[model samples]
Target: MTAPASSRLGIYCMLGGMFLISINDMLIKSLSGGYSLHQLVLMRSLVGVFFTLFMLKMEGGFAVLRTGRPGLHLLRALLIVFANTSLYAAIVSMPLATATALYFASPLFVTLLSIPVLGERVGPRRFAAVGIGFAGVLTMMAPQLAGKGDIGWVMILPVMAAAGYACMAVLTRKLGATSRASALAIHLQVAFVIVSLGVWAVAGDGRFAEGTDNESVRFLLRAWVWPETGDLAAIAGLGVMSAVVGYLMTQAYRLSRASTVAPFEYVLLLYSLFWGWSIFGEWPEPTVFIGAAVIIAAGVYVFMREDRVKATRRT
Candidate 1:
């Protein structure tokens, strides 16, 4: 494919994945009050694995899952596992807006890592655009950021998640040359299954969650129970979303430079705004619009700038 076309496709995949993940997160948060984290992970991973097999069939076949770079796959899986777990833990522990805002820092990490890891040239303007976009994210999240003064060290979880996720994306680009997108995704699912089962074996009885009034800790260590039919349906939705999102995210980073695709993630904030108002009835304040505008401008600048640079090289 031509560079411009490939870049656009990658952006579309990133936007689509982010849009679905926003909805999936809302559903998971709704379920977190009753279910343990490990149980949720185990259930979702099983369902996700099933769905991913279908994707595997459609996208070449099961043979595509084989990889010579097992070590990189193992590291990538560990990073993504840390990223998702830490982000989810932070979501249950703090305000969703706060956790999300903190996690958006991943784009900045991606831009920075693209330089040293991928050897991509991130120009000064592109770097500034990323910073401006992040500033916009903070602006949109200002209201939620205020009350978190007492959140203490719990706030670091999302940042850690961001770093882990950024590293994973960089690795995705590195592995994309040798592995299919489904391979990148299913390996992570297998890792999730193993980790969740290990946790269940050690503490699924709720002994650790017993006396914890802390929401995040209790959610993490809570004992598994027989899920209600409604909750099962909701988690099943998460699994489906997870499988599609996994492929979309992998394809996105695989096809474009991390720096090129990362800025488009700002659109996720807009998705959150729309979903928040429509589903949850939370009307966004003016700062949110202001921030959204800034984010959009920055993302557009990055897109045009990258396309121009690629064109110049081609010419």
Candidate 2:
């Protein structure tokens, strides 16, 4: 059946969320040259906590934070932390194209996990759409893929991150209406704060980072440094974007079937291309257009298939 009005809203939320994710990633990568992963996440999430509070006030107030599912909230927070940090490390250590193409496998994991985790049905066609979308992702980054011979082990980082993210999305669907979006976002930020502090306690002195030539490890073990005025502002911007993104992502999964919204994530690659051309001034190759066309076609097929399902129900 065609998705309900809520599901349509969910699709919009997913699209908005993915757009923010791409922008946030660009910011993260650009900033990584000077700061540690934990510092950026910690600072960004701290700012996000304030944004979350304002969102809560705007949405209704602290009373709306009531939820019987605290344990699930905690689990979701941890999964997101795992996913976020893993992807961050990957981005810092390697080219963005290689890291992203592997991480884009998330929608596939979401679709497969939804079957047993959320008890959602997947038709053959929907499965193909997700696969084709990922294929397009590969097409966009084929050169990077071809050159990563020795770094094959490193590729698993993003895939592991994808699984963590998939579990988090599926759980968001299972949580349904038990919690508000701000509550979810705040809990996640709090978790980030706690974990960031823990990492700080262990590695804050930069002792482990000594002689660490591996860039990813250095990003982890590096001592926290005070940010200058300019960089601090950029980190704060991440907080605002992250707050809005957290709400949109939670709303997306909470309001609709996971399968219905999962494929729309392919839309992120399109935004990546836009950001590349506009912000970073990278010229796109022709294959980028071919890959983009495939991605768009897959998304359109998924939308049409949903309409067909709606029509079959009416008959």
Candidate 3:
């Protein structure tokens, strides 16, 4: 395909993937009241694993899963498990847009980590952008800091989730040279299975006996209840959504320049906002809108700057 055509396809794939992901978050958040995080993860991972296996078979049978970098893939999976768990925790308590906006800091974290991890040098401009981006984070977090909001300490979960996601991104870049995207994707499902089962074994029974009123704690500690038919269908759909999201996002980056497609990811915030409002009657505060704008602007600037640097080096 022509570069322009390929880039357009990539952008569309990204938008589709982000939209599905936003929906997945909404579903997870909606189900948080009735399901333990471990139960949700375990159920979703089972479906994801089956879906991924089917995908792998269609792609090239089992050989496509072969990789020499199992250790790296394992670490990446662990990081993602952490990221997903924390994100779900945040989602249970915080408005979707607010949680998503805080998680938007992943790109900034990636930029900062690149210097030390990849030995990339950042110029002053991108450094300034990072500073401004962090300022935006603090702006969204101001209410929590002042002890005036409902979010409280749970707000930090998304930031921690973002950091974990950033680390996974860096590691994925390092492994991209040799690993199949399918392998990487399935490894995450495997990790989710392992982690979820571990959590269920250790805490599920005890927590079920004594449930707390706090949503976040209940989300974490609640035992597996048999989901209602609708909830079951939704949770099952989550697996399918995750598979589609993985395919689209992977194809998106594969089909175009990362810098070209990265900016479009900010659309996730808008999708989150819409879902938050429509489903939960929750809207972000004005301060959140301002903070999100700053974060998105900074992230886009970083991507643009990186593109410029690459262009300059090529010249």
Candidate 4:
């Protein structure tokens, strides 16, 4: 495919992936009250594994799953697992819009990591953008930082999640040259299964259990109960949504330059805002809007700089 066409496809795919992910988060948050996080993840991963295997069979065969870079795939999977756990924990208590806005920092994290990890030269323009982006983060976090609001330390979880996701995004680009998108998706789902099961086993013993008043702790340590029929169906739907999300996002980074497609991820904040209001009747505060606008501006500036750099090289 031509570079222009490939980049367009990558952006569209990313939008679709983000939409599905937003819906998945909405459903997960709705069900978080009745189910443990581990149970939710485990059930979803179990269904995702089957969906992946079926997709593999229909596409070609199991042969596509074979990979020479097992170590890299393992590392990517581990990073995604950490990202999932942290973000899920955060959203259980925080509004979806707030969590999504905080998670948008992932692109900035990617730009910063690319300098050292990929040996890419970041000029003054991009450096300033990164600094501004971080300042936006601090702005959104100011209430908690000043100990004025109830958000407290749980506000940091989404930032941790974004960092893990940034690392995984870089690794996805590195592995894209050699790995099939199916292989990457399957590896991540498998990792989710393993990690969720381990947590379920350990936390079931009462070691992690504390009090139910705290949403984050409740999500982590709550015992699993049998899900209602409606919730079970919703959980199954989440599996399908996640499978689609994983495949499309992997293809997004694999098909074009990450910088070219990264900005479209801001669409997620829009989707999250809709779901937050429609489903949960939650809305972001005025400060969050100001902070999100600053972060989005900084992220767009960084991408524009990268595009200029690429254009100069081509010329």
Best by lDDT: 3
Error of 3 at 237 (Å): 0.6
For candidate 2, write residues 226-314 as lDDT tens digits.
99888877899899999888779778978977567866877776676666657666544555567656755775676567557656777
Residue 49, candidate 3: C-alpha displacement in angstroms: 0.8
lDDT of each: 0.80, 0.77, 0.90, 0.87
**TM, every model:** 0.80, 0.77, 0.95, 0.91
| lDDT ranking from best candidate downward | 3, 4, 1, 2
Ten contiguous residues minimizing lDDT sum, candidate 1:
144-153
Which is superior by lDDT, 1 or 4? Answer: 4
Better of 2 and 4 by TM-score: 4
Report the Cα RMSD per candidate. 4.2, 4.5, 2.0, 2.7
Q: On a 0 to 100 scale, what is the lDDT of residue 103 in model 3?
A: 97
lDDT of 1: 0.80
Please rank every candidate by TM-score, starting with the best. Answer: 3, 4, 1, 2
**Residue-level lDDT for 151 in candidate 2:** 48
Residue pairs that clash (backbone atoms under 3 angstroms), model 4: none
What CA RMSD would candidate 4 show? 2.7
Error of 1 at 188 (Å): 1.2
- Expressed as tens digits, the lDDT of each residue in 1-315 for candidate 3 is 456999999999999999999999999998887889889889988999999998777767778778887778888999999999899988988899999999999999999999987888899999999999999999999887789887788888999999999999999888877777777788889899999989888887745538467787888888777778878889899988888999999999989898989999999999999999999999887898899999999999999999899889999
Evaluation by lDDT, superior candidate among 3 and 4: 3
